[model samples]
Target: MPSTTRRTAVAALALAASSVPMLAGTASASSHPSTVVSAPLAKGLYQSAYSERHHVLWATTAVGRPPVTSSALLKVDPKTLKVQATSTPPVTDAATGAVEAVYGVAVDDEHDTVWTTNTRNNSVAVYSQRTGKHLATLPNVAHAREVVVDERHDLAWASGFGDGTVVAFDTRTFKEKKRVTVPGAAPAGLAVNERTGTAYATDLKGNRLIAVSPYAKDPSFIPAGNGPISVALSPDGRTAYTADQAAGGISVVDLRKKSVTRTIPTGAGTLSVATDRRTGRVLVANRTAANVTIVDPAKATVTETLPTGPNPNHVTVAGTTAYVVDKSGAGPEGRDQVHRIRLGR
Candidate 1:
């Protein structure tokens, strides 16, 4: 049970979050006709990944702060949005005795594993995709926020938000490969080009993108919009899209030029972005506006905006379907939710 003071604080935060007004320059759901299916999941749903090989969706949930008592790794059927299996993380600390709560998740279909970021514990944990068994936990990652797996290189990369670094791990051995750091950078979202073995991270504090190559001696920086929190690459790996939280838009970057070609305004608090290979559309999750904006990257135009519940935190697209996870609920307890949207041709 939570303490009385903690409950009060949570209630106040929920009220404040609920009161946020919708921002300008975003389309309404009425303008477009699309099929949307949603389901209420566990608490503290933060990030999600879709496994095409397993035909399941992997998500992470962690509730409360230190001594996180409630947390689970969920394996869900993407078609029905039902939880197929749940696995709890192991305890990391003996004295304080805190559970390794997972906040970020990524799927490695090649190795039949799932990788998650233990943000509060400053570590990354790997689990068996088939059995949900706890495989390994690697410590010393500073404020891990996002994890991305490069199947071609057999590497899993995690963003260290606190120390302005990104750490790479060998998927086969579960060993630390290397750590790439940039001064004054606070990486929040990460994406990788599997063919090139190059990773891109959003510098939340510096308002830039850090392009990290495994073989490069020094990482290069590309300017982005204000507060780019999430990033995604196009199917051809020629373009990068970033959700600019502060600017309330998406920054489109050309990988060859290493610069932002345009910034498309979507809505308030654009927190996460994902590209749909089937339709060539870019989906941006607006946390404050309680909606997801779909853009056509070829035309640089907003085609549709789908309404989500409160505080939509992350979005991922698999095939023609898009999955979103949000933080807040109707009551003070803050039950999180997961939404699935089908993209029609």
Candidate 2:
């Protein structure tokens, strides 16, 4: 569980995850069929995201030292499993001043844009995915953590941990679009239904998951485990899986009923989560356990546990392949790195 001081941090089956976005899309199965790992990205790795149009994966980092400008958004070619480009999401821009700490990442294929949450700046940074250009910076995001693009509404939705709200912005105009109050005291993570614009956010203080529409007014909630840090939606979009850091398990939410259906015991420090598109399995990264647990959400049972390097904080899936991102200097593995876990291996 996170300390009272860390209630501010988080990530998620979530259509939009704090740490869990569909950062990797389904592609052809490889002939080798072995888990492929990538070298450490930096000293402070954040989120991993996938761009379908370009068939790429994006990894963001939190700059810890001087020359913080070197912190960047890494573009990985899924086909080759290699870092292709490194683009910086300007920390301080004219429109939004002093944007710092890239926390959450989400990509908009239609707009050819990539969005990142600047926690310190309380803003969202928008950049051109194709050109790696810093397009615009949106201010007043309210201690933003994770971000997601609502294509249907043509807006970007971000979780506001500091103000207990979800801030939305117009993608075209780069203006404040909506501000929906969260049910609980502290909103840490988010998951969005891209098709319906229905979003779910984790309230650590309230120990519940609040469901709301960025465009509409109806707001509802489901009881979550203690200290729910991240949330992910099932493939069917009806079930929500919240990684309860304090409860040391996952709270299975039935979106239709707006209630928790079950609690599946998991390893300690359940931080980030994502679902496998090919097998309908839920993958969770247990930070303290230094491993990833593959869960069958339908049965609410653990199927397998795979060892990760250290501080496996964020995870995403493409087909049966799972990409787990580790933080720097957390464990024996040390520096930031990514472990590719291949199921059915």
Best by TM-score: 1
What's the lDDT for all of these models?
A: 0.84, 0.72
**What lDDT tens digits, residue by residue, belong to model 1 across residues 1-345?**
111121222233334323221111223354444445566666889899999889999999998889887799999887666679999999777787678999999999999999999999899999999999999999988999999999999999999999999889999999999888887789999999988999999999998899988888788998888999999999899899999999999999998898889999999989999988877789999999888888988898888877766798999998878888888664225567677776655
Q: Would you estimate the TM-scores of all the predictions? A: 0.89, 0.82
Worst 10 residues of 1 by lDDT: 1-10
Lowest lDDT 10-residue stretch of candidate 2: 1-10
lDDT tens per residue, model 2, 17-121: 122112211111334323333344455788887787887888887755433443677787655445688786655545434335577888888898899988777
Model 1 ranges off by over 4 Å: 1-32, 94-97, 331-334
Structure candidate 1, residue pairs in collision: none
